[model samples]
Target: MSTDAAELTARLIRCPSVTPEEGGALILLSDVLTAGGFECHRVDRNGVPNLFARWGAKGAARTFGFNGHTDVVPPGDLGSWTHPPFSGFVADGMIWGRGATDMKSGVAAFTAAVLDFVAATPPDGAIILTITGDEEGPGRDGTRAILDWMDQNGERMDVCIVGEPTNPEVFGEMIKIGRRGSMSLNFVAHGVQGHVAYPHRARNPLHALVRLLDQLTGAPLDQGSEHFDPSGLQITTIDCGNPASNVIPETARAVVNIRFNDLHSPDSLFHDIRAKADLVQAETGVSIEITSNISGESFLTAPGPFVDMVAEVVAEQTNRRPVLSTSGGTSDARFIKNHCPVVEFGLVGRFMHQVDERVPVEEIHALKRVYGGMLEKFFS
Candidate 1:
């Protein structure tokens, strides 16, 4: 009998695995995988849960891998749902829950497919599944920790697929070949405080901050790049605590976030922005302090045999030619990319993270067949 992916999804949805909290999700998966003849390891670190399971040799010549996360974002104001957020309610032929679409369904489908694949026609190569509980959290230790452990244990994948929701409108409309880089810069402008009547006594930092912000947002970062849209920059927040209209605040704060393409790197973007800040400070005589954090760098799995094969499989299954896109925010694929060639494809993501998030039962089954086809093509 084929593994029931929809039922597995419902069972997983019943697990309350919110970020950094296992909620029995990984354990449930471990039980199923271990029983299916795969080696399972709990690579939990720093209070975050992770699972690594493999079938076949440790260092096989040809290894196909899959990555996904079970942790769901918190269900905000639970009263708005048609069914309880964690009820795993199956009605109208759709599974309703917080992670039903964002990814519990994808995980269930792939897990079912892998189990059936190995049970029927064990591949000549190995298969690895990396599931993390920290994807929706800070993500410092989820997949990264598993990868670190794999390095020490001498385990690696030749190519990996991250089952993030890739289709925006339909089940196989898109595949992620690359993702744009993301970073944020925080700026604090310092000036002397003084009375409003004495304009010359204080260097107004807010003036310099406004100018710096205007300078940064005045022009486009770039027109566009191959396989990516132009870089985007947004001033997310600005603050000055002074309540009195007559008082000149001593400090002004602003935060800017940039989502960039391959044409730029964090260092390059920071240098250019800092120069603008320096120039503004020199002209305005206000000290500006800038600090930055690079979340993930842009990367691409160039169109080749692996990409072509995945696309062909998707087109074959859904009868829709998928577009190779790099427009989404980011995923664990960013981490996996550092280890091996990685790409992302999964269910339609129209309802992910929204109230009453769900996936069609048929789509879940279809995703299994697609993943099964991937296994067949890879091992043949």
Candidate 2:
């Protein structure tokens, strides 16, 4: 790995910025960006610190943005890690840490590559880097605030590349042109408490919830779109919350999530899914209530010249033809797509968000080269 990449990755890993907390991660990035001649903005929105940095001459109509987050999911059961989760240990030609590949590494790569690129030659066009700290949590802040700030600042981008780790098996093997929108729902069916055998005396919410699941998951949401696949709805959980063996619980609940393609909107999809639950209400005495835990709505960027430029530079640097795809979970890219055409391409993500997260040191250098080349080619 390049020393700059290794040093910066180690710095980020040491910050301990587990979702919603800065933990020094944002400071590390801000310092790097400031040194690179970019004007940096530190905005605290909804309690999360988001950074937006830009560098280039005025009137450069062509602006490129690199977006990603500094936060990572919690390192569950710390005992499961081979090395300390925040140690940033290096062995076997890889770096091991929480968010090492999921992707503090990608953040480091883009930042360092931009620093180097700008130092050698002042950017021919504007380059903006948007970093957020609310990706793995409630996500009520972060990117949404950054985009709003950009709009108020009169910043428009030609294209934005989100450095989420997109590769599965080989570096540069996949580029996510879009993401499946995700929505999570918790449904509760209310009924009267009763004996197991008393059917008419008390409504059985459990039965209503079970039948509702049947109708909801019975078929595919749609046949898939040109840049996306058929919408999908998966039941993540179900609970009667009844510990008693002989008594029918007064309430039953189920939590479900859907990764939808462009075929549906979160509002429409939620309305449709809720209608199925309401059908049970029409026939039964039970009451139904549904609530949402939103991740993001699905979004896509139609492949065009800017996307082509990223693909060509990636193949040229890594010699791996990137697969143009939108087949992944939701990301901050989902939010950025509304402002500009955004695509995601980065290091191999085999071990991201997993115990003992690690990235091959070789891949780090390759990603840096790819990012540097993309910046040079796009603005030249």
Candidate 3:
């Protein structure tokens, strides 16, 4: 049986499963895996589809899993691409589409590798795949849900490898080992409305809000951690409208997002921020309220046999030492981290979510070889 990597990636790219929509993308994969001597199961949760498949020894000792998502972020500014964003056209030796580099390509490469691995000899250990459709949007819809499902169904994994475009300068440059936590907060300061000319008659919320923001931004959340960098807090937005220069605004609002390391927790940051706001209010009459959105917590799996296996495979196949970096933003790996030791690596990511995003045909073939090597070594 032949495993055509390009054709599989093109089929997946054709479906514009942007965010919460599957666009029949998972079905395409289910068909392919089902025909490849693997048992496939589909679970639809909260209007999103998550697919799981397995092969080789039943109840094997080590259940190695390949985890990925089929969804793509919206192709921003549609007018910028050379071809339709969902067309998945092949031109200039690239399979052009939105999810080509961010993901999808990595999935196809590994699937092809698995097919090749099984053909040579039945998989040495149990191989499982968890493909979710809600990764690009509110993560609550996919990996998090599917992981719970896996646990309930008695599915366990010894190790998990996420295909999240870990390469930066070139293929095989980086393999992410951990990720920092992400949290967002919005605070609005309240004050009495009055004419600016009568300073004693009204409280200015802007004055207190500015002070609160100053305290939050003045210092680093922390010095660099042993294995991670210092935490960063950025003020994303601040709005205070007092259309009239002669009037004091009733409210002033600011939004801040913090990318924190293991040194800090959401609870600690919330208290620290509130303390700063309180101090500002003690000096000014403005009172404030805060709301938060938490995406994930920082997590790292100490370098061990599982991570070493992937690094060694890349070294042998690419003939270059791969850097195990925890550098980019977070991914579904955040959800997977709760259940199993997870890491991400894939194609060059210079084009993810960009107009005319694509991966070279040669690069696709090379990636397939690297994946094949990894699977072979893991099962050997």
The number of the candidate with the highest lDDT is: 1
Residue 228 C-alpha lDDT in model 3? 83
Query: lDDT at 56 for candidate 2?
Result: 81
Q: What are the RMSD figures for all models against the true structure? A: 0.8, 1.9, 1.5
Best by TM-score: 1
In each prediction, how many residue pairs overlap at the backbone (N, C-alpha, C within less than 3 A)? 0, 3, 0
Instruction: Residues 1-380, candidate 2: write the lDDT tens digits.
Output: 22388678878988899987898999989987887788888877979988988888534778888998888889998999998889898999989999899788988999988888888877668888998998887766888888898788787777888889998788878999888888888999998888888767878898888888889888888899888878778888888867798798899999988888877888888898778878888888788899987787777677788889989999899787888999878888878888889989888889998999998877887888899999998878
TM-score of each: 0.99, 0.94, 0.96
- How far in Å is the alpha carbon of 351 misplaced in model 1? 1.0
Indicate the residue-level lDDT of 367 in model 3: 78
Cα distance off (Å), candidate 2, residue 375: 1.0
lDDT of 3 by residue, 1-380 (tens): 76988788889999889988889889999998888888888877878889988886546887778888899999988898899888889998889998888788988988887887778777658888889998888888688777888788878777788988888878777788898889999999999888889978999898888888888888888887876888999989888876788888999998988988889888998988888878888889789999888898888877888789888888887887888776778888888888889888788899998889998877777778887776777777
In candidate 3, which residue pairs clash?
Answer: none
Query: Sort by lDDT, best first: what order?
Result: 1, 2, 3
lDDT of each: 0.94, 0.85, 0.85
lDDT of 1: 0.94
lDDT of 1 at 148: 97
Off by over 4 Å in 2: 1-3
Error of 2 at 222 (Å): 1.9
What's the TM for model 3? 0.96
